[model samples]
Target: MEEVEVVVAHSERATLRVGEVFLKVDADQSRIDVEVEAMSLAPVPTPKVLWRKPPVLAIAALPGATLGRLGGPSTGSPAAWAAAGAAIRKLHDAPLPPRTGRAGRSIVALAAELDAECEALVANGVLPGDLVTRNRQVAEAALRPWTPVFTHGDLQIAHVFVDAGEVTGIIDWSEAGRGDALYDLATFTLGHEEHLDDVIGGYGTDLDLDLDVIHGWWSLRSLLAVRWLIEHGFDPFAPGCEVDVLRARM
Candidate 1:
């Protein structure tokens, strides 16, 4: 019998690995719908949909290893990172999806939310006030206007898979939709600033990307993530994690 490996388990969702298939159990059907639809629409490589049984969506695992994990050394070379960036560029150039996603949220709403989260991070003594304020200032750069494109809203390193310096697949499409292209850039390169240049080399200069905005998203994401991470049993402050990313700014 194949051992059921728990990939991730949280209140909102859980994923179990059974041999070559990954079974995703999400309470929100809409997210599953989005994942399925986005995979179909995406121009880049995506996991094969094995089947869908209501709360459980089974997908064939990609053959390549993940690009990297947060708070860990990246096994991918600069070429592999560039390939991932190229893939992202292709995804962004694709036609927009019907529904809005994380990157599609209104700037005003996001700003308000960031403010509230910053306050909470300080009040709850999660992060130093100075650290929060500095990053909050940096986060402001990303609040400005941007052209929306199809985006993998959560393009974390772990979501991307690579082999032989080429992108094999990208996963976790529930947060995928039309949104700011830079948000995807920032999210993918979040903690791994060292490879930002290689990624941009493949992504091209057409994005008119402002480094500050990338840094802002870094801060904005970290501040917003601290509470949720703690509550969900994740350690944002772990070395090379969210807190370290924030501290690197100061």
Candidate 2:
């Protein structure tokens, strides 16, 4: 018998690692369905699905370390980051998956949502009023519509595994669905902005990306996530953390 390692335990989901097997227990079956189906459809490297039995998804552990951690400097070389970018590009270029209930967020709706959330943050005194306002303004550019691409929904650095400077696998496809491509890019570089060029270079084409929109997504993501993280008993205000990411945008 091996000791069960708690990889992450949140209200909606919990992941436990035992030996070479990782078990993800999610309360939402639709999320799990998206994960399983997306992995099947994605052209990029992903964890091997060992088995599934409602609420529990058993997967084989990947062979490499994660690309990096949020709020921490990445030890991955520029090449590794580039490889991740290339991998994401490949995933994006693949055929679209079947339409689940999830749809891309409309800019108008996103704007309204951002407005409400920013007001809540200020009203609750969760963050400085100026900081919230500034980020709210920055998030405006990202609200515009664009052709939807298959997005990993939550493409955090920790979900990307690299071995020998190559992206061996990506995990946590629960959020995989049609969405804005820049949102994926923004999420990847949220706390690791320095690696943006490496990521863009590896994406294997000039995307003519609007830097402002990218920055906007960064602000929007951090702002929205801060409250959730805090409610979950996780501190986003830690030095050089989510709060730092938002402040950096200012």
Candidate 3:
């Protein structure tokens, strides 16, 4: 394996240049561990919300020529879902640092941010249509009785790293925060329905989470994701499809 040279550095960000690779470093802990990627850019922009404390564990680089192809399909398998669920559950159950009533930012702040993003999208000719309005209503309803649990705001397959049937590490903590736990589940199951049942099933039998609320928030999140993509130059009606399915189901 070749060692990548750290070419750019910031207090909270860095960039590494390898022979034929460019790794964008999002989080690094004391030069001992790092969360990085060789991709040209992240799929979504990081939110400007200050939520969780800096990560404790350091992520040592996994030796490989290509970091993109490191994880395989099995990461979404039933066994892998179980392992991921266990890991997520542990994260949620961990005693959260004292909530000053604002570590996660207020739901009102989130709505304001979403509205600003939506306006930017419309300005760029990416109309979110009725989806934007629907999201506002759903968000208001969901935030009424919010439970501030630790949530990996962007808990999707791409952020999970698996090896030999176990979750070796989780990447992309840029969105980590205190919010509804179900929102995390919704984000995880956004487009891939194949493993949703398994993922939800593995959430365990202890907590009595409201299914309707979860689905509602999931729908809203899907819309937000689509809007973001459109604003960033992606065609909403592209061959891959958009969040219409999620909207209809909601």
The candidate scoring highest on TM-score is 1
> lDDT per residue, candidate 3, 1-250, as tens digits?
8787875455566656555444554455532121222111222222122222344322334321211211123335577676666666766665553322122556777667767766665676654556656655664544545667766656766666656556665655645556677777665655554566676666686886666666666555655566655545555455323455345554
lDDT of 2 by residue, 1-250 (tens): 7999999998999999999999999999989999999999889889999999988999999988987788877989999999999999988777777753233677787778788889889999999999998998898888887877888889999999999999899999988888888898899888889999999999966676898989999999888888999988788988757899889967
In order, the Cα lDDT scores of the candidates are: 0.92, 0.87, 0.53
The clash tally of candidate 3 reads 0
Q: Which should have the higher TM-score, number 2 or number 3?
A: 2
When summed lDDT is taken over every stretch of 10 residues in candidate 3, the lowest stretch is: 32-41
**Please, what is the TM-score per model?**
0.98, 0.96, 0.63
Off by over 4 Å in 3: 1-23, 26-59, 62-75, 98-103, 114-125, 128-141, 231-250
Q: Per-residue lDDT of 157-203 in model 1, one digit per residue for the tens?
A: 99999989888999899999989988999999888999999999989
Clashing pairs in 3: none
2 or 3, greater by lDDT: 2
Name the runs in model 2 displaced over 4 angstroms. 100-103
